[model samples]
Target: MPSADCDTDHRFVKSKVRLSVKVAPKKRGSCTRKLQVDKLHELSEEFRRELEVRLDNNEIPDQDEDPENEWQHLKTILQETTGEVNGFSSRKNKDWFDENDAEVEDLLKTKRSCHAKLLTYPNVQAAKAAYRTACSTLQHKLREIKNNWWLALAERIQSYADMGNTRAFYEALQSVYGPVNQVQAPLRSSDGSGLLTDKYSTPFWVAGLSTMGTFLVTIGTYKSPPSKTYPNRK
Candidate 1:
């Protein structure tokens, strides 16, 4: 960065970031199932009989075997029984997915191949050109597919409302706004050895950057590196 000569005394604002991610421990014998809520009441008796028959056929776990493995085997039996008894709902696939799927997939595959080739041959002009071309083609295809999906969703919502399925209509409408995807990462010190939970964190951040003589401009709440301007003759 010191060797980057841009004809200016203002330096670049370089930041060192370290991410400390906490991975949750996986439950060995956990599983989830989806079934038609309305049909559960009518099929309660049938489900009980099927589950009893299956449990009778399955052998008891040996005392010498690992408990985790035995528990996992029991979970598998429950999952299989539920699927056999309740079965899957016949849901319709969105129409937009069927449109240009092969062409879109081929474009994506080409883009990935071009990216690998570019990485392998960094100085090759032909590889870089092919990568750029592949990116543009894939972007165009993805954009087309997105627009078609939105149009199809609108049509489906209208049909639900016309059929007087008030519950489904509202649900479909809510989906347009999309689900919340906000994740707040924990703030850490520059050294990455300690958490920034006190007032000293702000001062430390400012003092560290100040020592570097970095060019920083603060306009109200916005902070950015210095912007370059030029005199235009038109």
Candidate 2:
């Protein structure tokens, strides 16, 4: 494990043993660096102070000498300062289906064993065959479990809605959708026209028409030639 404040680079390891059950370590390969960006507002002062100090200490390489090296130096400083101040973020893994946990754990162990055997005995046809079979079985089981989980979740959400449990419904909705990152649907008018437009992929946030109310209008009202007077002229 990395520092307590930072687990972005480390994969979670679940180590539990029970009789007639198998446990396999989770792979650390998928680990990614996800900075605690949400904490920037709270920790910006510390980060900026330290970063400024490093810059003032003549640590930055001269741009005239080497632009690439200067950029790398600045990038390293910013990354280090951010990590020290805000650390990293790690998402909690939720169990997709608790009822089939034991079976899933066993399959995980078998798959891991097959993979290890394939790696150790690359030239052995039996090892490759076993690995492929294990992969297929594990994938099929996981898909089934996830499908069942989705059905159960939908029913649970519906029940919440039916029971008039607004708080629970909101929480369930949030859990399902997570955070919304997409920009809000916008309203705008075409560049040449002032009429309000609601269309696909409008970039502007909001717009209004120059005219909104109904009004009577008459066009091409008869105006006789200047030499010939009109009968309706007063």
Candidate 3:
């Protein structure tokens, strides 16, 4: 019995004897592992909540708050908190992003249909084509968030011809043409030619300078011949 007790003590001493070892962590590997673990933990609670909701909705304890909405609210709070702590709340960057977003939205809202009224003029087709090209380019730029489009459009429309291509042309023309033709026919014609009533003046100018020139030629030919001769005498 004494030999058996000694053997038992020897076995206990052998089992209880511990080795003291100090293993240094590999700095890069340990950092990567810790980061991965932290990211997993960061998202794990939300994932767990979602899983619980999906697996057993009735089992989840509710505190008078909708779970999905609450989760979204939590996510927003987390983002705001992270942004603050990480110094992501840069005022200049935030303002720039907001301005860019608003500019893109404004460009998106500028539809081609808004130009329909301006399309009624004779010279507008080419201008409208150019405008359509510009608008298409602008839309593409907006979607990609390229910032130079405002400058590009300024250069495109700087031409006087382009100005005439816009609704401003109609407005300027309308001011000259409207009162003259919109009224009931006046008792006397301005030139006393009787060739043009005020009603005809509207059509002449609205059809542009070519139509007005044609009207002048017709009226002049009816009145008198031009006092000029050709060199060939044909």
Residue lDDT tens for model 2, 1-234: 222222122545667776775688877677668778888998788888988987888565345578788788788888877888898876523447566889899988898787777667879999989988988998899999999888887899999999999988887777677755788644435564443554533433332222322111222454567796668866
Residue range 26-117, candidate 3, lDDT tens digits:
77653211122324456666655554554453333466578787677666554543443333322211222365777666654553332432
Q: Arrange candidates by TM-score, highest first: which order? A: 1, 2, 3
Model 2 CA lDDT for position 92:
28
How does residue 81 of candidate 2 score in lDDT? 79
Worst 10 residues of 2 by lDDT: 209-218
Per-residue CA lDDT of candidate 1, range 10-87, in tens?
A: 546789889998998887865544655556678889878987888889866567488887788778787777678777
Could you give the C-alpha RMSD of every candidate to the true structure, in order shown? 19.2, 19.4, 37.0
Give the CA lDDT, 0 to 100, for residue 47 in model 2: 80
What TM-score against the true fold does each predicted structure earn? 0.41, 0.36, 0.18
lDDT of each: 0.73, 0.72, 0.50
The list of candidate 2 runs beyond 4 A from truth reads 1-106, 180-234
Clashing pairs in 1: none
The RMSD (Cα, Å) of candidate 2 is 19.4
How high is the lDDT of residue 139 in model 1?
Answer: 78
